[model samples]
Target chain A: QKEVEQDPGPLSVPEGAIVSLNCTYSNSAFQYFMWYRQYSRKGPELLMYTYSSGNKEDGRFTAQVDKSSKYISLFIRDSQPSDSATYLCAMSAGDSGGGADGLTFGKGTHLIIQP
Target chain B: DAGITQSPRYKITETGRQVTLMCHQTWSHSYMFWYRQDLGHGLRLIYYSAAADITDKGEVPDGYVVSRSKTENFPLTLESATRSQTSVYFCASSGAGQGLISPLHFGNGTRLTVT
Candidate 1:
């Protein structure tokens, strides 16, 4: 089984709808969970970061991590067309000392916010 | 802020040719990372450096070489590029990359096509 698993979705939602993206991991060692947004032909940008198991809120985005189930989720409130992008989930096994290995990423979920 | 920048936003090269992607960060972060993003594979770490002259390989490090002659620059070179080497490359840096709470900043990415 892959270390991280995320649905590669082209999920379409109407404007102002709430969107939720999730990822599952097989490794329980991951201590930091992150969500990134990538526009077409662009690099991934850090959106939300959560440590261990908890909920973090930033602007209209909220990230939740449940270490017990090895599941993490990102929820978007009042989504807009500008929010259309690929969302990638990543986690590390306690940073692995200066970013050497430890990070495993999901395939990313493609989201489309219709106007 | 021009935090991190990558050279040659796009490139097209022939297979077997040597290609180098340059990464520069204005933050002077102690740790820098190189990652490749494919259509379905998400992001895979290729190499990383904790400081100048200190570099290490990551998951998909084969056929790739990295050098960190200076803290602000980490370049990745493909000695003999293969068709499979074609992907979008990203450079990232963090203040406390060895820990669990540092926020990572990413470059705009470089798209390389090996023909």
Candidate 2:
């Protein structure tokens, strides 16, 4: 199995709805968990990140990681059409070098926020 | 804003041709990376450099070459283009941190098509 796994979802939701995206990994060494948002024809940008396990929040976005279960999630509160984009889960297993061996990414989940 | 730039935002080449994608960053980050995004594959690491003259292979490195002769530039070259090599490529940079968990700054990306 691939190191990381995620559902390729074209999840459609109405504006103001709450959206939850998830990913699971088989590797236990992944220490840094990140969420990236990618717009069409654009590069993925870091939206939120967490270290080891626990929760980190930024405005309407919240990221949670459970290293024990090898699961990570991103939740969007009061979503909007402006939030429509592909969400990718990325993690790294490296030393102090930062992103050593690069990041292992899961197939992104496509999200559409309807107006 | 990252100040990371990629050249030839769009490229088209035939099989057996050689093509180069350029990446440059102004932050002088200690780490640089190359990743390719394909359908159902999210973003896959092609190659990365921790510093000038230090490079390593990621998940998919075959048929590709990278050189980090300078601290701010990381170029990816396709030795012999194949239809399978057609994908959107992104260049990213980051600072040194434990577990390499620092946020990655990515370029707009280069779209290459191999006919």
Give the per-residue Cα lDDT of candidate 1 at B14.
99
Please give the interface root mean square deviation for model 1, in Å.
3.1
lDDT of 2 by residue, A1-115 (tens): 8899999989999999999999999989888888999999888898987789999999999999999999999999999999999999988876542454578899999999999
Using lDDT as the measure, the top candidate is 2
TM-score of each: 0.94, 0.95
For B18-54, candidate 2 gives per-residue lDDT tens digits of 9999999999888999999999788898898989999
Taken in order, the candidates have interface RMSDs of: 3.1, 2.5
List model 1 lDDT by residue over B1-115, tens digit each.
7589999999999999999999999987888899898988888989888789988888899999999888999999999999999999999997775444466678999999999
Please identify model 1 stretches exceeding 4 Å from their true place.
A95-102, B97-100
For candidate 2, give the docking quality class from DockQ: medium
Docking quality tier of candidate 1? acceptable
